[model samples]
Structure formats: C-alpha cells, structure tokens
Target: MRHVDPAGTGRAGAQAQPDDHPLPTPGTLPDTSVTDPAVNHHVNPRTDDLAVNPGTDPAVNPGANPGMNPERSSGTNSGVGRAVNPALNPAVDPDMNEVVGRDDLLLVTLDTLRYDVAAELAAQGRLPNLARHLPGGVWERRHAPGSFTYASHQAMFAGFLPTPATPGPHPRLFAARFAGSESTAAGTWVFDTPDLVGGLAKAGYHTACIGGVGFFNRRGALGSVLPGLFAESHWEPGFGVTSPTSFEEQVRRAEQVVAALPAGRRLFLFVNVSALHQPNWFHLPGATKEAGDSRETHAAALEYVDRHIGRLFAAASARRRCFAVVCSDHGTAYGDDGFTGHRIGHEAVWTVPYAHFFLDHGEPTT
Candidate 1:
C-alpha cells in the first residue's frame, strides 16, 4: 500500500522504500554516523505536524516501561489499528464477513511445475499479482498424497493431502482420510464421508470442473474420475493438447465458463492447465510438434503457462470475489535419477508448486 517517488533524491545508505515504484540509482555509500540527507530534508506532504524532541524516544513514553508503552497497554494508543499494532489479528476473521458481496472459488492446476521453478518465477516478479496476494509465506512445500496425478487429485478433493510420515500403516492411511472421523462411522473405510468439493456443493455452491489431462479427459474409464467429482464438467478433444493454439482454445472455453455463471450465486471452478506436459515443444515461440524437445523447452512452456495464468487472474480480479488455488497435480522428471516423467519414485516427480490466492476475500478456513 506504500508509494515511492522514483524522481526523489537518493539517500546513500537508506533502505529502499516500501512501494513498488522505481528507486534512485545507487551512488557512494553514506556514513552511518551521519543522518540521511533525504530523511533530514524531505517533508511529508500528507502531514503538517513535525516535532523533534532531543533525548526523548517517541516510540515509548518516558514515564512508561522502557520495553513497553503504557498507552498501548491501556488501549489508548492512536496507532492501534495502524500497520505496527502488536495485537492486530489478521487471520481472526476467516469467514470474510468484513468483505461484502458474493464469494467464489477458483482452483487452477498447473501440471508438471516444480516448486523451485515457482519460487524462481515469483522472485523474478513474473507473478507480481499472485505475490501481492500471498502473505510472504511458503506456497510450494505442501506435499501430495500420491506421486501421480490421478491419485493425488483424488486425495486432494477428499481433503487429505500428503503429510509427514506416520508410525504405522494404519496411521498412514488414517492420515490420508478426512480428520475427525468417528470410529463407528457407517462406512468400512478409515476415511470420512463427504470430500471438500462435495461438502461445498451441499452448502449451496455450484461446482464445475474443466478437465485437461488424459486421465481427466473423457477417453475411457479415466474420464469418470473428474466428472463424478463435480456437479458439472466439460471435456473436449482438444482439452489436453500441448499446442499453442490449443492453449488459446482452452482460455476461450474458460471465458465461456465464467460467463455462464448465474448472478447472485457462488461458484467453484476447477481448471487444469496441460500445456506444460510432455511433448510441450509446440508451446515455444517457433517450435513445431514434429521437433522433439527437452526440459529447456518445457521451461519455455511453463513461462507461457504463467502468462496465461496471469490472464486468468486478471479476469477473475475483474469479478472481485474469487479465491484461486494454483498448484500442480504432480511434478515431471526430466532425467533426474534416470526418470523421464511422473508416475515414478523420484523427488523431481513429487515436489510440485502450490499457491493459494484470494481476491477481495480473506483466507479460507473450510
């Protein structure tokens, strides 16, 4: 929320401003013993009051404790709700009642992306919008219950993602289920009934899935997995294509899906981006499908996918009431320990990126 003036005078040893604006060029470093000229001369236009009292610390009253301010302890501090309040509870309102209007959920699955790649892109500002929404936390370290896509997605919808190892086989499987299940539940399985998506639908959410992979596409029995998971689903022949034109087609269909949402109703949209899968050379700028490619080409494909993802977020932000979860079903191995793609026991095949973003909404508690 801060703003910086790019044309302002440089403070030799001062820290960079908190705004996204450009900063002045670095020159000779300033002497730490001397006060910064910018701080001494620069005047805040928003405030007219300026007082400098020698030998007095403004942060703490002289009559109060040296470590704590009496005003803050008495709840009489003027800066109570400002940025530096110690008692500010950012996560207290998880239901997001403070934000008015309808709420919607968007879950995006970017297939085959690794956690390292996501961190690199995020550091480079390629995902500036997503970075702004995140609270500077780790978004890629969450584990998947299964190394493969189908099994992992099944566990995700069931609300039992992978966690650290357990003591025994029974405990491991119990970790794979919805927590808080009664021992005398009707079902024979250790898992609890009603997955997250189903629970959302039962709570009046309109659930929909836009399939993207061969496992999700309506080719054989694999097609039934995704469709049965949602209230409505769509799978086309070009759904999982790796071509550039196919990417545009998928975006077009996504636009149509967003447009079809009824007014005054909350919707849950799940989409899988398949352009970064194997045979992804066509996603490059001048590459053709016939030309075999390597992991370098896959990186290019991921960059392209990032751009499209930015577009998707832009569209959803326009709606102003959407929550987005972007992650990979599983990672792909590019000859790491002699493994090619996923479905194998390789660290590269299991460590995938995961990011959650909420637009005009607070964190999701359910």
Candidate 2:
C-alpha cells in the first residue's frame, strides 16, 4: 500500500521495421547535450543577415559581445525566432488522437489495503515494476463510496465514488448514469445502470470480471448482484476466504483470460483480490495458525499479495492490450481507536489505497 503524487498527468505492427525515429533507448542514460538535428534544427535568417553585415567587425562580434549572437548586433533585436517543425511534435499529429483513443484500459481492486501500508510498500520497492510504470500515479487518500464491499462495490459499478473529504462546491456524478434513470440513444445512462461494466459493454467494449469475494461468486440470487454486469465472469473452486492460494490462482486465471481473448477487439477486465482481506495469518511462511494478530502478520500478507500483483502487471504488459486499476474496496481496522476489524467507522477502516496504471499508453488527459 504505497501512495505517490498524481502529477500532470502502443502497439502494433508486426513485420514493420523498428521505428527509425530517434527515441531514447530504454536502459540507457540519455545524453543531455545531444540534440536530434531533425527535431532541433534552428535557422534565423534575420540573425544571419545581421551577422554578415560588413559594418560589424567579425572579431568583435564573436569575442567582444558575449551575450549577443554573432550574426546580430547588441542594440538591435530580430523578430524572427526558431519554430519547431510540426512533424517532430507528436502533440500536433492528427493520428495521435486516434492512437490515444485505441489503447486499452486496466482496472484492479486491492480488496482491503490501507493508505499508510500502500505508501510504505511502494516506497520500499515492494512494487518496483508498478513504481517504474507509474512514477507519480498513486492517490492514497481517496474516500470509498461505502464502508464495506457490497455497498461500496454497488457504488463503484454505478460510478459513485465516496465523496472526498475535502470536496468542492460542484456536485460530481460518480457513475456514468444515475440509478433508475433512462439511457440516451448514445448508450450513456442518465442514472446508474448496473455498473460501469454494463456501460462499457454498451459502448462496444467486451467486459470481463474475475471475482474473489463471495458476494460476487454468483452462487445464489446474491451472486447476481454484480457478476451479471460483465459479459464473462469466473469464480473458481478454492477461491473463497478459507483458501490460501486464492489471489495467486485468480491472477493465473486472469492471465489465461487475456491470452484467450479474440484479437483486435476492445476489452475491459476487472478483478477483485481477496488475500489481504482478513485472517491474514496464513500469509506468512512459517507462522503457525496460532500466530496472534500483529502488524508483522499483516506485512507478510501484504508482501505475498504484492508478489502476485506484480505478476498480474507483468502478464498485462506481455499482452500489450490491458490497463490496470489497483485499489481497495474498503479498509480494515486493526484495533486502532479501540476498533478491532472493518465494517466500522474508524479512520483505518475508511481510508484505503487506490491507484490506476495504463500499459503501453501515455498519461491520461482531461
């Protein structure tokens, strides 16, 4: 559970030759002094003409006037300035808009991560790959819409986020649409329509869910609460709270799902990991079942979970068609403020870790 600042803030091809365009090669230090002639070529004709003016002494121009350009006189200024070629700046390219829109999106839910823990782990390099991918991409203090999984997830599906403690005067709509409202012809809902998964599907994106919590297992009428939102959903055997390898197994299945997707189709995948939820004692290597509830046990569980999270990220990167959103459904209380577990109104139970990362895509824009 690590928190980093959110700052200002793909693909394809095949047999095509490596882009001859000069890009900073990965794993190599960039030479600051070197400039690409194609990108940084500067020619000021006015300055050139002034430099060759016969009245000025060439020796004086170079040696006497340190600040002035050799081609221009100290007293006179030229209006002409260097202009960047449109071809060199990607921002101005028409194709750039298309490229940005076509990239994939990934969203993850880290079932009960705390903000403080997430920050500690992130700072300690427990999540190096994620750190590298998203240097300033973490937001720690986000408010969960609900205090527990079922309620909070319902809000999430409806696009209603917990109201930020330091909220602005403007009313923000959490879900794409409000609940019990009609949808426009564009498929945009006026109110919450199941959840964002359903909205995405209506928008022509294939939706998939890899659920871990019992509420999402679709075992009975209760399972229908959220699983139906996705086009395909899975909850394997040994995936319940009693199972130890639940999180890892889910990641393995997620990798398989991504591999099996039809080529060239847009996809939306959501996963809920259960390892860090509660009864985290089994996460430690040699700790016996008798191990008491302690911070050490929590740390061990988090570390184990972090390893699996790293695996999921690696798999997504390999597929080159995913974006990940890693966050917590809610925070669990650990005897802080006289509170023992979650589903209570303690700061520890309210504040959770939330972060979003994209694969093979640049920073997001408004």
Model 2 residue 148 CA deviation (Å) reads 1.0
Show the lowest summed lDDT stretch of 10 residues, model 1. Answer: 41-50
Candidates in order, TM-scores: namely: 0.61, 0.63
Among all windows of ten consecutive residues in candidate 2, which has the lowest summed lDDT? 1-10
Stretches > 4 Å off in candidate 1: 1-102, 128-134, 137-139, 161-193, 286-291, 317-320, 361-366
Each prediction's RMSD over C-alphas, in Å, is: 22.6, 21.9
* Candidate 2, 1-96: lDDT as tens digits: 011112200011223224422567898854222111221111111111112222232222322211122222221212212211223222211121
Best by lDDT: 2
**Residue 287 shift from truth in candidate 1, angstroms:** 4.7
CA lDDT of every candidate: 0.52, 0.53
Question: Across residues 1-366, which tens digit of lDDT does each residue of candidate 1 receive?
Answer: 112224322112334444523444588543111111221112221110112121222122222221122333344433322212223243321222221113567778777666666667677776554566555744546555677778888876765544322332111111113334321111111222356565445334456676777766645657555555665555565667555654555666566555655453456677877787787887667876677666667767777765555556654544446856677777777777787878886777777766554666322211
**lDDT value for model 1:** 0.52
